[model samples]
Target: MSKGLREYAIVDIETTGGSAERSRITEIAIAIHNGVEEIERWESLVNPQQPIPPAIFGLTGISDDMVSDAPLFSEIADTIYALLKDRIFVAHNVNFDYSFIKHQLGEAGWQWQAPKLCTVRLARKIKPGLPSYSLGRLCDVLNIRVQYRHRAGGDVTATVALFNLLLAADSEMVFSQMLRKNGVVQRLPANLSQNTFDNLPVTAGVYYFHDRSGKVIYIGKAINIKKRVAGHFSGHNIQAKRQGFLQEIYDISYERCGTELMALLLECLEINRLWPKYNRALKRVEPRFGLVSYTGMDGYQHLSLTKLLKHQTCIQSFYSLREGAAVFRKMISDLGLDIRFCHFPLEVRLPQTANDLVRRIQDLPDQELYNGKVAAAVELAKADTSSYFIVDRGRDEQEKSCIWIENGKFYGMGYIPSESQSNSWADYKSELQRHHGNEYMMQLIESFLAKSNSRHQVITIDAEQLDEAAILKPVELRMKML
Candidate 1:
């Protein structure tokens, strides 16, 4: 934290994947700056002890062949530690790159530590109302040349340039903001600006957003409202129209809770009672269907769908019945599920063509274009039923969960835990039997259980209750059974 990038250690790392706890670093770069002057630069290739997925190789151009003979992080541990220690760790998405490297260093028996700063967060504060703050996007907007897009060295250098631009754009405000002992109190989306939310306690709490008319437009709860609400206003998801609308409001309010569980309970109570229009997460007052069950010759079998009724443990609430159904179909196809028993007409096969997908996309509100162009985008999105899997970490070191999703919807989810004798898929099947018949619970379970990466068996909760101990307890109990 200096007036002009003081002794900054702007850093970046190309990694095998996203999670530091699970993935490995493939490359690293550090650019040291004294004020605005570059003091030195360093870069290296690292042996990740894992195969570089072909997709990542294609993205970063750092392949297994390229890194096979590179120095393992252990060999360069001392050098990296010395290079970064006491220097401000800076990057585009600083935490991501920093965490990956720090985790790697720790595994190599070196505890890497450094104060961190993110260009993405800074750019949002300085250059608001942009289409994107991604390092590449920002570079393009600012006309800053980056020779390597995904490579560590290329990205670090670009981040330094971007960070410099942000500083130049608003030197007084940005620098003054940084001077605080605590992190900067960033400009919240219009409604929350009157209050310095940064000083808002990190304890569990429910935060409220009020429209200019004094109507409660949204209510949200988080373990750290300071962090979570900041995310909503951070301008990360630019395409979210609702966020823009919320930004237009002029007042904010909040209530604190002793624990995240209490915050969650309060949030559920307030959202149901207040019925805010802008609170997307809790706007609707209904359960979403997950699966449809019926009696069969063998026994009761559950079929996944999106239609939901009351009295079941609903997982995710949807905007409409159509949206819910779309989520269900996406999940069903992702899990390679059959359509016959789920109550739909037997011939309602997964749409495999542009026309079929177009019809489906026609149902959701158009997100991409003007007027009638939604028909076109749906045609494009539905052309493929790309299958994907969610890998979740389990309760113990050796255990993990695999949640399969297809086409951006919930599908069947399975659990994986440590212990050679336990079968996670089997445990999931049993849980499905007990909870599957309930429509709301089924979709909730499917969506919550679904995972894109198998890093560790992580608990599934709403974005708001991500840190609630009460909510996590059931998840842990279920994991214990497996």
Candidate 2:
């Protein structure tokens, strides 16, 4: 067994929200297991000082009232710090729980650092075919018992059981082999995890995609920026393509715009200004579409595909004029548009010699004017924006509540009013704006809240039910099977 499972400290925490830097931990639990057997256990309630947002209270089931009388984090920092020091910070989703602790400790004047092992990630490497490895799901598969669901002690206990199962399933040597085989993906990108993603305020913003070398490769905008980036790293085929690029990415920098429109506008501006080489799909300097205008004896002002750089707008995008013409002919047959005006015009308006035809063409569509949906999609596909809502189940007897989202980041949170001067969605949109987010943020919020699928909301709506981190869960089962 590689290094004999070295002193394991399985930990878990219930937090106010996603960000470690901003969100305070309301509860914490840890289980220390020496190589041969389990050794020690500890847990505590931490006073965050700030009022627990209603949504957070609903999610973790630990309310402001429960923790308001507890010791502040400062009071327990040293004790907790000493417990975690030098042990492998093990957790179901180590990145999420550990980050909050580290950030809190740092604020307490301690530079906390430790190696981490994620049971979620470990199970992924060891047992690749399971539908889900959430602590609850794993316990069901292995029949482990967990009592206090969302409470810190309950989660840590479950994580401890899950880790023991992992050890039993694969010897320490096997884990080492996998770790070595995976070739040093041990620490996640320094700030990419809970530090950056969880804490990211859901807001409309422009985010820059960078290589490990700290170079900007792509720029994007989103209503929830955090979700967007998480989607990129969500272990799909695309994530494999991104691994090399993302591994080189050590930092993610962002600018929060008050609205999504501004983010989009700024994204366009940044892409043009930076022209990051990786964004070649958008930056490629070839005109793929053209405009074809038919001017004939019985001319019915028709515009279709063209080849001479002076024709009507074409449907298919291509690298050269030849390809453009070929695509135009295909689109005519594909969409079943009028082919007579597109491919074979009986009477030609070409210069008998050449100069006359060129001069007569006034409304002939220019190549530059071919900025249709194809161009727009091409440009948009290069953007790196991801979005999702930060849903906190309502503490009061009300329907679930959601804050606006943008680019997988938190934009703002608030309750929608009953009598707003707008349509159903438009009212919530105005609420997002009223909360300091603008149209772009509202649009992002609207997109998520409007969806019929149940996958978008990450937190359990009841606030009483405990759940598992869905990160690294098979994308198919990550959200409800949508």
**Best-performing candidate as measured by lDDT:** 1
lDDT of 2 at 423: 29
Model 2, span 76-108: residue lDDT tens: 999998898888777775656766787788888
Prediction 2 TM-score vs. true = 0.42
Model 2 gets an lDDT of 0.58
In model 2, the Cα lDDT at residue 336 comes to 36
Error at 40, model 2, angstroms: 0.1
lDDT of 1 by residue, 1-482 (tens): 44664567888888887666667889989888765766799999999999998899889999898899999989998998888887777776555666577767787788766666667657766787777666788888889999978888888788778877877787557644643521333334432342446556665678887765778878888878778877765432323254345445556678765444335545665776788876666444455444444344533243444455566533344534555566656754654433433343334444443234333433533333322242332343344343333444432356544544334443454344445443233334343211112223234434443432333333333323322423333324333111
Worst 10 residues of 1 by lDDT: 432-441
